[model samples]
Target chain A: MMDTEHLGTHISKQFNADLENLREEVLAMGGIVEEQITLALDAFTNNDSDIADKVIANEKMVNAKEMKIDEACTKVLAKRQPAAGDLRLIVTILKTITDLERMGDEAEKVARMAKAIANKEMAVANVKLHYGALLHLGNHVKKMLHDALDAFARMDVESAVNVAKLDNQADEEYNAISRQLITYMMEEPRRISEVLDFMWSARALERIGDHANNICEYVVYLVQGEDVRHKSWDEMQRLAKDE
Target chain B: MMDTEHLGTHISKQFNADLENLREEVLAMGGIVEEQITLALDAFTNNDSDIADKVIANEKMVNAKEMKIDEACTKVLAKRQPAAGDLRLIVTILKTITDLERMGDEAEKVARMAKAIANKEMAVANVKLHYGALLHLGNHVKKMLHDALDAFARMDVESAVNVAKLDNQADEEYNAISRQLITYMMEEPRRISEVLDFMWSARALERIGDHANNICEYVVYLVQGEDVRHKSWDEMQRLAKDE
Candidate 1:
């Protein structure tokens, strides 16, 4: 939970409560999105159609939650007209939920891939062997998302920068996995479709890392009142380290 | 240009001017993004490295424009505290710019692919024969984006809905292209890497269609004050028709 005490101390207490509630709702949404990624990866790893089905079912709830939070942020903006940090808080929440919702969409993509792979008549051993790299990438992005939300909750710029940096690592992993999958496809052209599915799953996880990084960037924007989006690594580091 | 007449008419004339200025900025940004897609497709179709270079160079300007528009919108929200339709306009602009910036990124990606394919030793005839479906998909999405921006400029729900529905056609074209590319790759395993690049370019174009669709949805939200995001096609059509 955010420290509601410092948010809009000059404003009415009700406004503070509203901001607090908004933050919690975003975190709650983040939690569900995080779980979706986990279950999606698990479904792929274990070929669990039931788990994949659950993830697909959860997407509706995620979309509704995004709309709900977006409305709340708009209400706060319209009624409270919060300025400065308070204004940034509302804006950040609005942008953060969009990322969360997209992350959920990526998770759904992963689930669909998992379901497709599970229903195929391929051997489970081959599936696991081919997708081990995907699981590694999935865990990397899943952790990145979790830490990004944590950074947002505490308004921690250092933590945000740290998590944002992880996206580069996730990208490297994705590239390596893609190269390996390409090799597999080249070696066994008959399995090209299956290898491509894993490639897409890896792509989805990589995008999850991207969404998490975007959330971290939003945190920096919220705290510093600066738009660091599209900044180079060194420029972003300098801004984040300037405290 | 959006008619500045009705926006914030109840407020001070200055605030109305601010909203009008903001709308024009968004349209200007949309124009640049639209051109990026067009140039990227031409670069790929013609195997023209010079045009590809231009698209890559244009991305930075696109990013800067997005940040500029975002800052202006934030200022308006803080200074004007706009409500009702005015608030929705500001929020829609904020969200719309994010999609536009992403579209710029996708264009840059397409340009990079074109450069890669151009620098390769493959014959231009082979390239064209292999990528005909990709060019077809690219043209479909390009037209969809153009229509989507036109819809946004007019804020016409009918136009917006029509453009939003085009995304389904874009997806089908993308699917056909992907399957064709897969067949090409399977037929000539040695050309796997080159064909995969075309696949990625097609994927980028498909995503551009998605971003364009998102813009149309934002237009609907702006006009109708309804959240049509994540809604089914039928649901979105019903809401749009409800006027």
Candidate 2:
């Protein structure tokens, strides 16, 4: 009977080890998703189709990793029947994989935008005015994505709340960029379609920032067991401010 | 041993019953969300704060139902290791809950906008322009939501595809509304902020329409085992268009 008990303990330990490894893999995939966003933004800034193509090519990797992570989570849930922290970790992994996959899709959108603009001549030719704001906005979003992942991994609610704050800034920047592009189109209506595409790309990045903020909210839930979503922005800031 | 087997079967049946009930609740919630959108639009057109207040109050009900449905779904998933059709039903319930919740939020936004404009004097005072477009757009969205839910509940892939096509028309109408509102604001700079708020509300509704389309895509996946999400609108039309 003692030997049987020891064998059960050994199996539980091995299962936990595997679960931990799965968590690490999920985080690693998150890092790749973040990098893809950054590279996709770089492609947008530089008008580099090659880099954009690379980002598109890497989508399969992200999707595969997402599937594998999801399967691993299900396996852990089914076989181990993890309780409390382990269960929360597995659930978080499943949710984070979804966020990562969505981020990958956003990167692909940026890549498609890059490809669309790569061969087209500048309709207005004010390259700095157009690309500079986009690059700035893209960089801010990429940073937000990275910080959100870090916060999730560390269970750092403060960092997660900070990501929420950064999203407002990103929104402001996006609005400003939209205003600038609108002005450009109003000045030269012929550039309307191209500028509209660029606006969508910027909107995609802003949406990515929003999703990062969503992940941070999940982190807060994981840490504090509270739902901070759907609250007033001011209220969320106050609740998470001291964190 | 026979008694134990009977107990197991009873538990499973009870869980399945709970799941079916939860799906019905989600559909009911979806119905309320659709109603809220229509009522909010009616308030906007009729300039009726009473209607707007009703919509706002109804949102509380929507929120409460969302929570109940969510808890039921979690309970079902936790206690029952559902497979095949049962698993798909649970997943659809979960996804549909999110769509319903978001729809509720969008309706609330429209209600808020109606309240904001209730006291204010319209610069254009074009009731026809203001109420007519919103009502038409709201009707389109309501149909989309209804059809999407019907398709989901029935596991009807063809109806799901049809709902996707309707979503494009809604998008076009939404874009036209945006342009009209922006043009109005540009003509009357004093009403710029208020008109922009209205435009944002419209955009939120349009986003809700997009989510409905996404829900339809999931329904298609559930029924046909196909990922039709990333396909082009034109290609989807060609493949699944109803004559």
lDDT of 1 at A232: 75
Question: Best-fitting candidate, measured by DockQ?
Answer: 1
Q: Which residue pairs in model 1 clash with each other?
A: none
Candidate 1 lDDT tens digits, B191-239: 7888888889999999999999999999988898888887878888898
Superposed by TM-score, candidate 1 places the C-alpha of residue B135 at a distance from the truth, in angstroms, of 2.3
Looking at model 2, residue A145 earns an lDDT score of 86
Judged by DockQ cut-offs, the docking class of candidate 2 is: incorrect
Distance from true position, residue A183, model 1, in Å?
Answer: 0.4
**Candidate 2, lDDT over the whole model:** 0.76
For every candidate in turn, the CA RMSD to the true structure comes to: 4.4, 5.0
RMSD (Cα, Å) of model 2 = 5.0
Task: Show where candidate 2 strays beyond 4 Å.
Answer: A1-7, A49-85, A113-120, A125-127, A178-196, A233-243, B1-6, B47-64, B81-85, B109-122, B125-134, B168-203, B223-243
